[model samples]
Target: MMNMAQARPIAPNSPSQKQKLPAPRRGLHLSPHMVDVAVQVAVVAALAGIWEFGARFGALNPFLLPPLSVVLGRIWEDLIAGTVPVDLGLTLYRALLGFAIGAVIGIPAGILMARSNVVRWFLDPLVSIGFPMPKIAFLPIFILWFDIYDTSKIIMVAFSCFFPIVAATYAGCSSLDKWPIWSARSFGAGERELLWEVYLPMAMPQILTGLQVALPVGMITTIVTEMLMGGRGVGGAMIMAGRFADSVGVFAGIVQIIILGFVVVKSVEMIRRRILIWHPESRR
Candidate 1:
């Protein structure tokens, strides 16, 4: 029972008594994804504006470089007529099919190479020599063997995609630490269990990276084969446009290819992020 004069008043700024400022008002915050989108949009818009201005002012040659509006109009007409969609579907199918084939073959071969001395010895020399050879140089032989058709083109794409995937997957598999294998084996895990639960998961990130590397190669191979073989795709359209000197058609094909490549790469990145959600780097 202290008297009034002896009682100490509460200090407003004392540690436990202090008031919280409302988290410094984090208003109008832009996340990293927002920033990336904004930057990409700005860059693309700026480039398009420059191209349009140059074309309109005759600073750029209309024959080689059609105006953006003309290109867009051609693309719109093709889209409305449904020609572009068919060609797009064919191109996408070939690229994806080839990529799937490449991945199926490459991942297993790479894993085998990493795990088995016999496989590594048998494959090492061939992989070393073939990887550096320009894959496009083999196109004529493939065309002759498979007959200037979808088969040849798809095989070309697969051939172009395989080496990088194999290399990356092998590297990933070989880099794995041994402690996990020992632990799993000590716990009576079989070879299949170790591979499925430990090795594959550990190698997945690099395998996905290999797929990323392979995908663009597949797309490029498809387009090149279409051009060479005079077939149904944007590349074929470009070749025909070149013969007729239709700048608008050629530019439209170019624009379509740009859009396609961007979409494919972004989709792959999205998938990679989704699959890597368990990784600490992906959490950031």
Candidate 2:
């Protein structure tokens, strides 16, 4: 009924903008993550403060509780003089070498077991028999065979790290969504194409998680080997400190190992976040 001059233009999307893109609602944000971080910081600060006071006033025995200051001072001294770096570098080298060896054997073994029922049948018994046994139980035999050298240490670590990787990878691949395989095959996808597109992508999260599970074990294996083998490491340092009854060194070594484990775990988590950015929890 309106004339042409009275016609109006349609506004560009204001109602849809409000309705479709509602404001980010807020409520009880029970972020366990932030709470966990806060609690850790608070506890650590409290303990440090307590240690500092107890040490200064002689309330805690200096021999048994050497305090944060002493431990930090010793660590700082070693850090500055390059001793800690050298020892830590050697430890890192051993850990990496062992992890690499384990991965070399584990990935293919896992893939084979996953794809072939016959291979899984043959290997399941062997994996079950060996997986639960502590790898350190072989330390004496390893020493006798490999003569307390880096080879034995590396193998021990590799052995400890291997089973978890294989198990997780096998689980991942075996349980992969079957639809992808069927869809790819219907399209005449080759074996390699199916593996690349369907198998690997689906299994990657589990594989990375397996690496996470194995990494700390690798670190511990190397340190334990160092302790038993009398070579240089924080573990060896702990042993040496205990023998000399040096509480400072013993606690310092323990703290050092704890820090190393924390760092390694954090690194793994960072890698997981970066690589598996599409994971559900990660998206949240």
Candidate 3:
């Protein structure tokens, strides 16, 4: 028989019998991302201030290194006149079009290479050779083949962006863990279902990273081609400004390029987050 004392229920308000639980601590918290953004803004502001002071006081050549104010004023004037917008639109169109083409080609090629030894063997050497060679060197050949119009420029941008996307995709595809594949197989998923539901989702983060890499390359290539070919782009505007020795115009063109690039990259990041909602890194 059990003792009455051992079997008795503890009184509800007895301090000695009750379990002690830790109270939840509450305090002010700051996000690391906020801190990072603050630091970056501070640094950029400091640099701009120094530059402005130098230019204003003639510590730097006003002709060669205009004040940030002068540059900003020129950018505003260009914006008001609609010149910047037209040039910016053309640049964006070419860059994005090239990027789209490259992405469509490169992603599938990368996946094929990852899945088939035959495809890998056939393409690996070409990728290896082309990846390191300066893509700009091929511009002359492309121009000769496709003429000095938008076609050549688009092709150049696509070529420059392709290697990065393919490399990133291939790396992502090959580096994927086998557990997801095994789990899908255990569930009796066929090859097509596994490709769509398992492998693609697992590879998506890396594929997005590849796209990110390719985007910047496409923009850069478009700018370089425009600068060389001299037509209908921010790069062409910059070239003309340089030719006229208009430092303010040159700087304004640069600012436009910076703005355009930032907007595009941020858009890509947003798309990446949406696509990778289930990914832990993407959430952060």
Candidate 4:
């Protein structure tokens, strides 16, 4: 009973049917992020290749700049001998301990300074003078007082880190929007509640930025302290290598420091992203 057009069963592979279905995707498609990562990797690889080949081909002096393989071999030897782990552990411990001490003391002082005029007046001069002055200048004094030990080293690092953290915290807390405070007050939020719920949460980004700045400074200070104190750390190892004119050992130490710094910095950035998930910058 159907008409001729309907009577003929439509082909399953007809043009109309084919048009309704999605076209088959061909080959690999890379996202922008993947492309960016590829570019970065390529750049690093190129630089490393240049370094390796230049030294191997005598374009670079073997004594001043040994081939990358030689440096890596030295590092491998240290790793196999178990000395690298101990030295790395000691350096990280001192740096992290000092950073913790600074953060613990600095955050509260910053908040207090922002909240109270009296505290600001009292601490302002000290922070101003201390922040600008080379913090390492006080190392000798610390050495005299605390001796050439972990105590002096840690204190020196903490001192270097404190100023940046406190400054960042104070700036963050003081430059807050008044509307949020007024709203919280109208809702009967107590001082403690306001501080915990409003102030810290709002100021966290700046505080984290300060921490990022302080961490590198702390590491630098730790290295200097280690070198001066002559202890079992990467800095000490580097100094010893220099004394013995061991360029390979010195370069190996440098590589270790670079790796340590890169790892810590990336870790901090990840932490910041996790903590500030709601922040606008985190979306980027």
* Clash totals in order: 0, 0, 0, 0
Which candidate tops TM-score?
A: 1
Per-candidate TM-scores read 0.93, 0.84, 0.88, 0.92
Report residue 44 deviation for candidate 4 (angstroms): 1.7
Candidate 2 backbone clash number: 0
CA-RMSD of model 3: 5.0
Question: lDDT: which candidate is best?
Answer: 4
> Please, what are the lDDT tens digits per residue for candidate 4 over residues 1-284?
77898788768999887888987889999998799989988998898899899999999998999998999999999999999999999999999999999999999999999999999999989999999999999999999999788999999999999999999999999999999999999999999999999999999999999999999999999999888889899999999999999999999999999999999998999999999999999878
lDDT of 1 by residue, 160-250 (tens): 8999999999999999999999999999999899899999999999999999999999999899888888978989988999899888898
Q: What order do you get sorting by lDDT, best first?
A: 4, 1, 3, 2
Q: What lDDT would candidate 3 get against the real structure? A: 0.91
lDDT of each: 0.91, 0.86, 0.91, 0.95
* Residue-level lDDT tens digits of model 2 in 1-284: 99875696545676755576767998878688899998999999998899988987899988878878889898888789877877778787888899989988887889899998999999888888889998899999988888777889899989988999999999999998888899899999999998888898899999988889998999999999988887787777778878898888788777788888888899889988998787785876
Residue 26 C-alpha lDDT in model 1: 62
- How far is 72's C-alpha from truth in model 3 (Å)? 1.0
Stretches of model 3 off by over 4 angstroms after superposition: 1-28
Candidate 1 weakest lDDT stretch, 10 residues: 15-24
Model 2 poorest ten-residue lDDT run:
9-18
